[model samples]
Target: MRNNYHGFTLIECLISLFFISLFFLMLSGVFSQSQQIFQRVESREELEWQIFLIQFDKITEKGTFRDMSSTALIFEREELHEGKVVTLAIKYSSNKKYVYLSNNGGTEPILTQVQAITFDRQGDAILFTVRFLNGVEKVGKWTIP
Candidate 1:
């Protein structure tokens, strides 16, 4: 009788390789998608930070103004030692409302958003907020003075 050996045939090796390659390809695709999502999130975060800084600077430097019926008035100043306050208010599009930043004396809308605006108060105390795209809000408050 001839000796019989059991082993994987050439077809088996090829099939195994094909499955392995396919798995690796799918994994690479998932990795690429994850990277893209991370980048997008980072970009959004950066944008939010930039917007906050700009709005803060404007409120701190220029003071605060309120506009009603196309009229503008300044109501607060940083030198009051009363501290500077900035509030971001968001309005819906259907209401034709705009976002406004209000300080001790005045309120002026820095920009309009369809969803939300984050508020950050600084000078004596600093406060921050995260306005999510989905209209969710998160607030952070700190004392600087």
Candidate 2:
């Protein structure tokens, strides 16, 4: 009498399972790396936003308001240079994508990666909203002194 077995050997089954587990391990690693990268980017964006707010506060607190528009604010600030008082005209404007600060006829970007910015006035305070390209919105109010 003879018998035939149509099944995988123990070694073959173990090898196949090892390969499947290795594939899953690699897949999990990819997901983990992507998640970490996303978190880093989000944190960096938040940090940039906080720094921008600080700068805005500093400029608005000590400067006299010259003009305010929907996307721009101009201020006249006095600084002492060489024992002489110099009046500086500073303009903060947003051009739909980023914020710029202009002084002495030169313009530089103060913040980047933004979608839009709006400025509104409420009594003695200025209300502003910033929208980032990544769908984050920040609202800030500063009182002119």
Candidate 3:
């Protein structure tokens, strides 16, 4: 007696390979999308940190603002900084208040809760406040006299 054995034909093997390739191609798309999302998150965090540092440095420096008054004043001007106009205003309400930094035509408030500062017509003795997106507030005072 003779026995006949049969294995997968060439066509069957080729079909299996094609299916596997298709599956992997689909999976690769998903993996690439996830990687892009992670990169975007990292970029956002870096940008936030850099902006916080710039704001901190500007506030700590004494020459950033010249004087404090009931009206707003332009403290520093940078054409290359995010295309936003930067200014410092001294707002005297019922009590003495200071606005250290502002932006976007002085419509955006960067710093608040300013307690006291010395301001003269000569633009001497600057005091201001710094606030970060994390809600951290820092008070900086400088005396020119």
Best candidate per lDDT, number? 2
**Which is superior by lDDT, 1 or 3?**
1
lDDT of 3 by residue, 1-145 (tens): 8858579889999999999999999999999999999788656645644564476465545335444453443455444657654554433332433333444445343333434333334345444444433344444444543
Single out the weakest 10-residue window by summed lDDT for candidate 1. Answer: 65-74
lDDT tens digits by residue: candidate 2, 1-145: 8779889999999999999999999999999999999899889988988888888777666577878888888887666455433333333444546787776567767778888888899998888888888898889888776
Query: What lDDT score belongs to each candidate, Candidate 1 first?
Result: 0.52, 0.77, 0.51
Q: Write the per-residue lDDT of candidate 1 for residues 1-145, one digit (tens) a residue.
A: 8969689989999999999999999999999999999788767756765685577565545544332121122234455464655443222222433455544445555434324433344555445554555454545443432
TM-score of each: 0.45, 0.76, 0.36
Q: Give lDDT: candidate 1, residue 114.
A: 27
Candidate 1 lDDT score relative to the true structure: 0.52
Better of 1 and 3 by TM-score: 1
RMSD of each: 9.5, 3.7, 12.5
Judge candidate 2 at residue 132 and give its lDDT: 84
**Which pairs clash inside model 2?**
none
